[model samples]
Target: MTRPHDAAILELKNLLGPKGWSMERDVLETHNREARGKFEGHADIILFPASTDEVAKAVAICAAHAIAIVPQGGNTGRCGGAVAGQDQVLLNLKRMNRITEIDARDFTATVEAGAILKTIQDAAEEHDLLFPLSLGAEGSCQIGGNLATNAGGLNVIRYGNARDLVLGLEVVLPDGSIWNGLSKLRKDNSGYDLRDLFIGAEGTLGIITKATLKLFPHPKHIATAWVAVPSPEAALDLLALARRTTGDAIAAFELMCGFAHDMSVTHLPNLTRPLASQTDWHVLIELTSSRPTDDLQSLLTDLLGDAMEGELARDATLAQSDAQRKNLWAIREGIPEAQGFEGGSIKHDVSVPVSKVPDLLTRGMAAARDLIPGIRPCPFGHVGDGNIHFNFTQPLDMDKADYLAHWENLNRVIHDIVAGLGGSISAEHGIGQLKRDELAHYASAEKLKLLRAVKAAIDPDNRLNPGKVV
Candidate 1:
């Protein structure tokens, strides 16, 4: 029995050759599921295009047949942006992984969409440069997905998000037209910035095939510290103090609740607690200087001393050795993973103004507590940039499935608070299937109209990544 879209799938398979497309169960399972097991995706055929030409041809075939295309990278996204649906073609780009050019003089790297983030960072390091976009999934996540999500990571405090790091992108549009905008130049006063339109579009308008990314001088002098703060308010004060103290050397400023720290240690039993003095809140701060002569450690020590004296911080542990620095970072980075050990955890990636972060924390926690009593509020993240991974662990007595049932209700209350504070509901994470309706509800009518206009203008048939961010 031949299906209506079978010819399109056959065309893609023929175009990609035998090695390009897969119908195997295991391969489909991996490509179809979300990273956190929240959503299970579906696709009739999953493809692995080898080059830009192959991708363009495949997309053209799909467009001609009116077949839906779900462009996927490493599938490490939390928002399920790359997750495909029934009858859609999953265009996985892992085979296209290539760092085509690394121009040290230009401080730019042109890489294929499938290149692993950590691989690019190491490649940059080899040239005595730095590609600073980093997160928990750096080892597995692809650069294309990072750009699609406009990813913000540990370095965003000093460097900026993935959007800020990218100079240009090469995209295969819905109609299968290749737009090579891979410019390495920092400045371009063009009519309209088309690169940005595709960067965070989640593959709705186009499939990002490659990118030219900005790199910086690798920091030679580095300092890391775990400081205890009384509360979110004190954390903000410490953030201000560190920013002024470090100048442009500030790399990361993370805030965590006491329970978040405890969960990290518990998740990895071998992990060492960075600080002895446990308080309600903690801050993991890092400062880096490219200059070899900069006394970053001494400066950090002095800054911590001042912060402690001013009562902005309670206690601090400075990482004296590289091993100690790694230990501190390990504890800080393990927070996202540690949530899984606990029962069902409701997650929110929201951001408010740095000043209003305190209010967000207080009000959000209180509201969640009222909704679900004894639900452990494990809030933590890059407080320097005001993005908090405000998550709630299910109660001891509650069933995991039952607790997850309140996901929608919980999101509404917390998101309402975020709106009141003039904060973004989906900050670093894009509005994937998880928050598509939420985007519609919270977004202004004018903004929604414009977004739809753009989507319609690019993908007239809604065949490119349908059921995604509009």
Candidate 2:
């Protein structure tokens, strides 16, 4: 006997035509996994809808047949949020890639969910504006995925996350209803903000089709610096000092553990080590402003001098040119991929209060080391937002599978400490299939109940991105 979803798949293909549907093994293979390649699942069909109406129609058909649909973007997610399972229908948004509108005067850009992050950034730059939410994956990640996860990148220290960047959204509800909420208005307090509900819902409530993103004036004067610190505490102190001096001109403050920097230099090609001595901690700082007369370098230098005088930063180097700035940034941006090349790592994207970061790292690293004796803890990420990617590499000559086998045990140890510190188990990467169980374990009963109720209300059939988030 054929399942109802099988027939639904056929109906969808017929409705969408060849250009809108694909079942080729190669194409399906490409859609099976996320950027990390950790959680790959097979999909029987991949649907490509060119517009929100088509997406609504396909979703309605799938909902009617009780078929699970996974909304996918550029597939650059660290979590397995976008991968389609063998029993699911993959709804790819690449065909809908478009910049619907760019209103420089209004300080907003309306874009399709499938638009690449870099493309939108480029568009904003063309208009002498800035789209500040950026990460290493910006070249490949999509706006929908960013909104879905509420991504926190380097500039999050200043401009904030993807959620803050979005003013309004166009979403396809679970029942296939198109909600046209794409307003560029900065202040619209009509009622409950629906955009906030779906911004970080991880596609559990609905599929985001389009969005109106906030833009800022492009910075005319920019400065980049790499600073050496004795510890996370020192780095945190230096961060406070910089903020006090520059106000909000401080654009980014990224923390890099020496282990992580060393790994990048060891693994990545042409990546020279930045600091003269291997300090326990380092911070990549960036300052920017639209004012042509803004002396970001002088401000940065003054802040660094104060930090050094206060014994917060041991040494620092400011970038003299664009190439030098890029080189300094490459060390920070390449850490994750370099760790990947090293071996299979048990990764956690966790966040604690900025004040508790040092303690969190101290206790978490100690516990992890005791568990695996020689496990290498490479904790690095957006220190400005207090989010860290606490990842562990296998011990020297230890079997990779053996170390991975202890992932659950290690996670419990680390997460228990996080909970004690009033921190989140899954921060920016989000609770997709990768952290769904963790969500259940960490979220309060009231929060869990509310999330579940929202999911039930929007996607009663649980056909949209099933087994994702709450």
Best by TM-score: 1
Mind giving the per-residue lDDT tens digits that candidate 2 earns over 1-470?
12436678788987888899988989888888677878996787889999999999999998888778899988888779988776788898988889988898999999999999999999999999999989988998889989999998888888988899999999999889999999988899899999999998888788999999999999999999999999999998888888888977889999989889888889888876666877888899999999998899999999999988999988889998998898889999999888977777999999999899999999999999888998989999988888998988988778888889998999999999999999999878888888889889988999999999988988888888888887
Q: What lDDT score belongs to each candidate, Candidate 1 first?
A: 0.90, 0.89
Each candidate's root-mean-square deviation in Å?
Answer: 1.4, 1.4
Clash totals for all candidate models: 0, 0
Tell me the deviation in Å of residue 276 in model 2: 1.8
What residue runs in model 1 are displaced by over 4 Å at the alpha carbon?
1-4
Cα TM-score per model: 0.98, 0.98
**Residue 440 lDDT (model 1):** 95
